[model samples]
Target: MVQTYTSPIRVYKTPFEFVMAAYEKRFPTCKMIPIFVGSEITSEITSEDKAVTVIERRCKLNVDAPYLLRKIAGVEFVYFIQKNTLDRRRRTLVIEAWNESFASRLVIRETCKYSVHPDNDDWTCFEQDAHLEIKSFFGFENAVEKLAIKQYMANIVKGKEVIDYYIQELIDEGVTHIPRFVPTGITEDSALDQSGIEDEITLSSLNHMALGATASSMTMDKRIHRDSLYKLDADYIHRCLGDLDPVEESRIVELKQWLQEHHKEKIPSDAHLLRFLRARGFNVEKGREMLCRSLIWRKQHQIDRLLKSWHPPDVLKTFFPGGWMDGYDDGGRPVFVLRLGNLDVKGVLRSIGVDGMLKLAITICEEGLVKCEEATRVQQRPVSYWACIFDLEGLSMRHLWRPGLKVLYRIIEVFEANYPETMGRVFLVRCPRVFPILWTLVSPFIDENTRKKFIIYGGEDHQQPEGGLTEYLDGKSIPKFLGGDAECGFPEGGIIPRSHYLPDDLAEMESGIDSISINSESLYQSVSLVKDSYHEVPVIVHDAGTVITYDFDVCKGDCIFTVLFTTSAVKIPSSTPPASPALQTSISVIHPDLKLKEVIRPIPCSDGSSEQGTHVADKAGTYILQWKGVDPTASTAVHSQFSFDFGLTSPPKCKVMYHYDILTQDEFRGSLSSVQSFSSLSMA
Candidate 1:
């Protein structure tokens, strides 16, 4: 198979003649590039006027192949045939070179061209294109392919420097410029009259001398110390985007210095720091503040551990659609494609609840970061972010449900705050009319910097003839659903059936508010209480012998907890709302003429921290777990303005921090067995 690479056009602000002089210095030997062993001019042809020179040469390269391959091939040096065509009249030089030593089993061909810049007479334009084919290489195709690409990429940087080095050499030697070739003699056949190098000559050179100076000859010496000559430090560039330029060197130094002085543990690498700087338009102070805050947030959230530890609940993983794509975008950023229109928004919320969905979102963002790190390793570049492509193919007004939108916006807000600059790009495709309405509602919440990265297309705008996704994505990586060649098998999107739901009790608990369960983040809830009123949560048990066990951590305030169970003879209040788990009025009002019992008193606390208890309901009834708060004046820690309560109108209030759970019947068998074991041990 053949591997080809075509570089983006590189501009050098130097004249063609000056660039040529530097190019010529790369032959035989150059310290900037030690791989080029030497070159021999096998043939040379010159025009009569010395205006053109065409040379054919055999260039030797010190191949950096594996030792085993070197031994197998039995060679230390590789040779290539280089053909050079220097057309002085046109101020252009084209070099074509092909490997000769490995022509049978492998082939390496490269073409390089240098011409006067179209818009600037004093500048030159250079481009390098290379192709490598390993027809059959002793089952070392992959290794050979990597070696070829590695060598080629290394030479690309070095080649530019070669010109720079020679330009500096000429500058230091006081040979500032080489005037364009011009014929002088009147006779066409005279050495001073004939046109040069238009017809033939093989130009062969393995590696260009120096990147910092190559082809950019005229400015070589000046660029040597200029901060913006290339990208961030070469090492940083090698680590993702070899082309990202942070604001300036001084700003980088300032930020790094600040981080070192003020925040040592959170100091970011130059490459990682660049993203934050870019997000804030390179304002060192603003970038530093954002970075510091992000570091704190990560530490507090334990985000480093989240990626490996946070897994979405099974119901959500299966029912809530949209997943990471198996492919990546053109720039090596992971591409996550989701068709929002096709997802069952209501169903998802009903299944996972707002908190579950939030967890899923956090997990997704965490996964993206993980993928970005992996890509950076694979591409040997800094790719700290991922690209997301949202396909609004089926988006409509139904998706704008008020509650779900609130959840989504809250999610967006969380992501915007916590994962700044995590989105490399967002491609909005097949947007429906409703999209704008939704966008208007949420766009204001999106970060301004993030808004700039959104690329939107209406209807089939992305598939139009104009520069579309194809401009940024490779053909094979494009999703076939988007009219590209690549096949995308993710999402498997559709409406999740109502039958997909778990039991109503389970669903209610998962959805929150309607059930006793609360998000782990809000495990300990606070209740404000008055001296006479009680905060009660009723547990309705249908069968006898049901077990109700609960646990709660007290974060603040104090209260006495007791179990209130109803008698079977008492009729449930007809006026009471069916979903009301508690009667705001005193329990006596509901069980007026019957038994209302307190099965357990205020439990003694082993430590003044939390409370746990278990109860067995031998008869069907309504069980109320109540927190009866007392006046703060009774507490040991005391400091207050009012020495006494005025009246019922301005009575002092109490508060409690608590959480509870129930395990019924068979579910508590393990608990019963453990209790039995403890009882037997105590007796022993």
Candidate 2:
């Protein structure tokens, strides 16, 4: 009967991801489980039997129990269960299985495959073996039909002989290509003690294998040796690969041929070699051509001599003079130095043969020649000269040394002090210091103070003013000085006039004064003169012709001065006349100070029967008028007096006219006229 088994499976896209996932799934749950994983095929019944045992022990399932099984090709599974017995023990289980025919067929259809061939093949035997391992591990049912696997297998068969030869060569070179399970003798001491040639040969062989050379011909023992060698000196092997001489014409040609032969194969292309050369700082194009030519003449006389006699010490000493081996000679063992000139150029040259040495020498010689030329040119050029003068008053002295005036001065001073007569003949003074000194002395001065003032003219000055000039210069008090009107004149008795007076005729004075004459009779009409008691003294009147002088004392004391004219019943005209009897009694007096005042007084008027001339007196002087009238009670009374200090002219006729015809003769006449009766007074 066909046996069936079930196991818990976890699937992932990559082997590494699968392993990690399986570990996480199995840890901490079941500890006692048998796990087996390898890339090999066995009978189906045997695989089923093993799966049943693992499930019964780890999943605690009966041997005969029915279960479902799921598997994905190229994937493995892990499971956990309990073991039988009174005290059941937990354990883990793992299994491998293949996918169904449909999925396997699909995988085979989608992949790429190739047929085996003897030449013009692709892929490596080692990669083919890895592919087989992956197929087995994943239980790939149709793995043989999968294109990737088929192509890999075909390349393995086709390149079988070439791969075998390569592996045998590596073994002869002391490199084991396939390792077995054994302790490798790769101690640090063994690697450190390796001879230079042995180290280089081992490194080169290992690099070839690491770069995907087939190792099918390597025996298990040889494989172990290869692995041991790498473990001992992996870094050295890596360094050798990087230092591969792109300009070693023979090696480059061989590599190129190999690449061309397997162009269709997945071997590294020419671009890869170019990248390798570039990483080593080799000029790829030049190195490639050089390497090809060198390879074609591999056995030439000069190359043979170079390989036999050339040593790293000789190269180092020639390229780098004194310091070549400074820090590199450790205990006389010549510890490898990876300095720029040593490891980079020298190492590449050693790998490439005699031509590389010649190229390196040429480069070093050219660089040295350039440096020597630069040094010689620098020595030949003239040195620059500079001098300075300090503590000088004028800017010329300070700037003189800047324009070579100092050197010129030195020449002149030396000539003058040593050979004055020779200096005149040589004209050295004119040629040197004398002309320069004259130029400096005569150059127009640029006052720094003026320049700075012009620059900041609008800026405020914060410095305090000195001396008594402070008050005059202070901007805040300038207005006070400008607006003052102080009396200013020359000193007394000084030669200069105390005051400069212009001649009166040349003064062109304003016409503001006049003179006039009047008779005493006409003076009565002149109120100004009448009010002044006909004073004949020359009195000045303002332009208004009003007698500005009057005697208030006489008017108030009731002094009567005469008028030469006869009294008329006709009224004297004036701008304003009395409007009431009380007002008629009112009198105005001009005080000595030119201020006017009203006085009250009693004056007698003529009786109507009395002739108008009855009141006239023999007094011929101008008289001042005084009047008195009763108060509102008709019992109490008040008096008014008026006096004008008039000129000897008839009082300028009163401009106003008053009418006396409207009153009856009895009413119009009274001892004391009513102030209202003057309302009709006329003015001439």
How many clashing pairs per prediction, in order?
27, 53
After aligning candidate 2 to the native by TM-score, how far in Å is the CA of 679 from where it should be? 99
Lowest summed lDDT window (length 10), candidate 1: 199-208
Instruction: Put down candidate 1 lDDT per residue, 359-403, tens digits, no spaces.
Output: 778788878877888888887777877888788888865675544
For candidate 2, write residues 1-684 as lDDT tens digits: 111111111111222212222333342332322322211222222232121232222222111111321234222442222221110010112332222333323322111111111221221111111212222323433443343334433333333333344444544777543221121354434533443355456656775666533353244336555433212111221222222221222233334444444343233323234333332344444545443443333234243345336444433443422111111111111111111111222122223322333433333322322332333244442111101101111222223221122223332332222111110000011011122333333222322221121110000121124312122222321112122122212111111121232222321121111111111111111122122132211122122212221211111112222211212121223454344222333222222232221221322322111001113222222223332211221223432333343445433211111111122223223212322332222111
Error of 2 at 658 (Å): 99
Best by TM-score: 1
* Ten contiguous residues with the weakest lDDT in model 2: 421-430
Global lDDT for candidate 2? 0.25
Best by lDDT: 1
lDDT of each: 0.68, 0.25
TM-score of predicted structure 1: 0.42
